[model samples]
Target: MTHDEIWRALDALAAENGLSASGLARKAGLDATAFNPSKRIGADGRARWPSTESLAKVLTATSTGMADFAALVTGMAAALPRGSRGPAARRIPLIGLAQAGGEGYFDDGGYPVGGSWDEISVPEVGDPNAYALEISGESMEPVFRDGDIVIVSPGAPIRRGDRVVVRTEKGEVMAKELKRQSARRIDLRSLNPAHPDYAFDLTEITWMHRIVWGSQ
Candidate 1:
């Protein structure tokens, strides 16, 4: 990919992930400005090449494999058809609690039996890895209310302060902001004061992922 293309992609990714290039670099354990736009342009005004080490650090920071990184660099960032941009227009089949008992988590056939689904519209997020979920309760309000549609990007990494959807081994699904994570437990801050803040044992978690964009 050209330097401009890489710079643009990195800029978009940084914005979507709520991070600056320097912040992303820090997260990736690299020197600040490793992926800065300024650094992408040489002193002679030519395109500067990205170092392999810098790319490796970024991949690790984003928890993305080389192949996935390659796909983004190739301008095939998992996007859907143009007309399917709205949340109400693109929905994935999600089996609810009533149907979840015998269903597997996701790949094991435990979630839902079919692809029947609804549609939601979320703006500015073009990744096809993004999908929508309807808020079922008022646990997260002001920011997210009951019936609000949330677009989730399973490809996004969990980060401090990011709103997330968490599934417990007991078959409970909840939404909250991530405060911290460790090998043993996760701390969650409730968006609604009426609901108690969550401190879940990590071992009991079935899955935890971020909400990329949401529309009320």
Candidate 2:
């Protein structure tokens, strides 16, 4: 088989086993970088092959046989289990980060309630009332980048040290890491390195919601 095809089969097998390629290698008692892309090509520019011992260990670790590997190679294997699927078919409102700071996008309870939102479908959702906001700029980089979607659970508890979405009575919305909270004030660390840590009076914050998931 061609190198690309073999690598694709290996990736598929890793997902079927619910582990990443590096994770699979580690589970098989090999170096974590064994299946990494950097090692997929040789210094002489020839296609690299997985060592036979590595293959044997991987198969034994996963309780998989050579026939299963062959099935993957030939595209004859059963689909990965639905529970391990990435996203479900349920839909939720998707709002842009820029517009999220505007008025009328949220209700008093801090849940998405207005009609200005677009929509997106996820593979599954634990919170039926959750909504999504797409990051718009490089401001939240390192932790979240442009176009990344964060699923906000308005009903979820907001605790100290959790990443959160906070709205204010003045029509401002912010996503940041919660540093502390008290009856009188809220302190936060910005995800964007360019931004400074912030402190706000509890009276100024209209609502707060903890982010439960994200599509990276």
Candidate 3:
């Protein structure tokens, strides 16, 4: 690709991802000014070309694959939209479970709301993907505790041995490591054995799925 095209792609990608040139450079583990507009201007006032090494550094730091980078450099307009998915995931304010029943902590319907909640960002689960709930009790302690934001990705196929957040129809929400699942039942090990091992029938579970990630 032409040097101008490469530089422009870098600039556009950085902006779309909410990064400054320096920020994108640092994210990719390169010299802060590696893709700066000034760096592209030569002593003779012509634009300098981005070297292969610099391009490789940018690719590595952003975890962008080569074919995608090539598509970006080639002036394909589609690359712009793909960058939106890079870091813009769904996140919402989280409220501790203990405080959930307190004044102005959540809506009357139990949806989280108000000034007491802290914003917790997480990856968006596309297509019937579910939401998140903050952990509140010590019943599932050591692995998950009060105030932890648990990102639940329901509708994503669950595999055996994945750690999950399970909500029972009886209104108990708990985190457990999955051991096995059958059409009629789910076998799980509690994070806190003080609670005992769980083996619930599918009818008893209101919702059950993996915890993709979490934050303290």
Candidate 4:
């Protein structure tokens, strides 16, 4: 399997079990930091993969079959049994990226609130608090163009290299790739190289949500 797909499958497994990556590692009798984003890369900047033994332990701990795990890796876990069809589409809140920076769109915990939001039908996401944001500028172009709709999941685990939407306490919102996150700071990489990368203190961020899907 591809490196990204394997890691994503592991994350999906953890989420499906109502556990964080560290929690899944702990449940499998591995070190609590084994699945942390920091552990996914090495000191020399190379990818670090989870050992087969660790994967086996996780499967045993969760009682998940290899076939099911493979499905997750292939992003077909949402399909019906016997490969019939995917989950039905459902309505979720939709808002512009610019408007998301304004008040009345979200609760303190970052969940979409208020009743004035427009709605769009998308394939079902596990997170009930998921919502969509329509892109507006060229700052994130080449990857996310203007008018692109991205699905954001507040409940999803954030990992290194994942694209995310971040909102600052001062009411600024932007989408970038998560380079790294430490206790005190977060590093972000812009999708468009012309745009400057960003680094912010953890305190400056009001919320950061993973972008689970995007309409290119």
**Which has the greatest TM-score?**
4
lDDT tens digits by residue: candidate 1, 183-208: 89999999888889989898788777
| Candidates, ranked, lDDT | 4, 2, 3, 1
**What's the lDDT for residue 1 in model 1?**
48
TM-score ranking, high to low: 4, 2, 1, 3
Candidate 3 contains a number of clashing pairs equal to 1
- lDDT by residue (1-216, candidate 4, tens digit) is 567879899998998899999999999999999988998988999888889999999999999888778867754453213232355567899999989988899999999999879999876566788899999989898999999998888876677887899999999999999999999999999999999999999999999988866788
lDDT of each: 0.63, 0.78, 0.65, 0.86
What local lDDT score does residue 14 receive in model 4, on the 0 to 100 scale? Answer: 97
What's model 1's overall lDDT? 0.63
Reference-based TM-score of each model: 0.53, 0.60, 0.47, 0.70
How far is 122's C-alpha from truth in model 2 (Å)? 0.8
Clash list (residue pairs), candidate 4: none
Highest lDDT: which candidate?
4
Q: lDDT winner between 2 and 3, please give it.
A: 2
RMSD vs true structure, all candidates: 11.2, 11.5, 15.5, 5.8
Query: Candidate 1 has what TM-score?
Result: 0.53
Determine which window of 10 residues in candidate 3 has minimal summed lDDT.
75-84
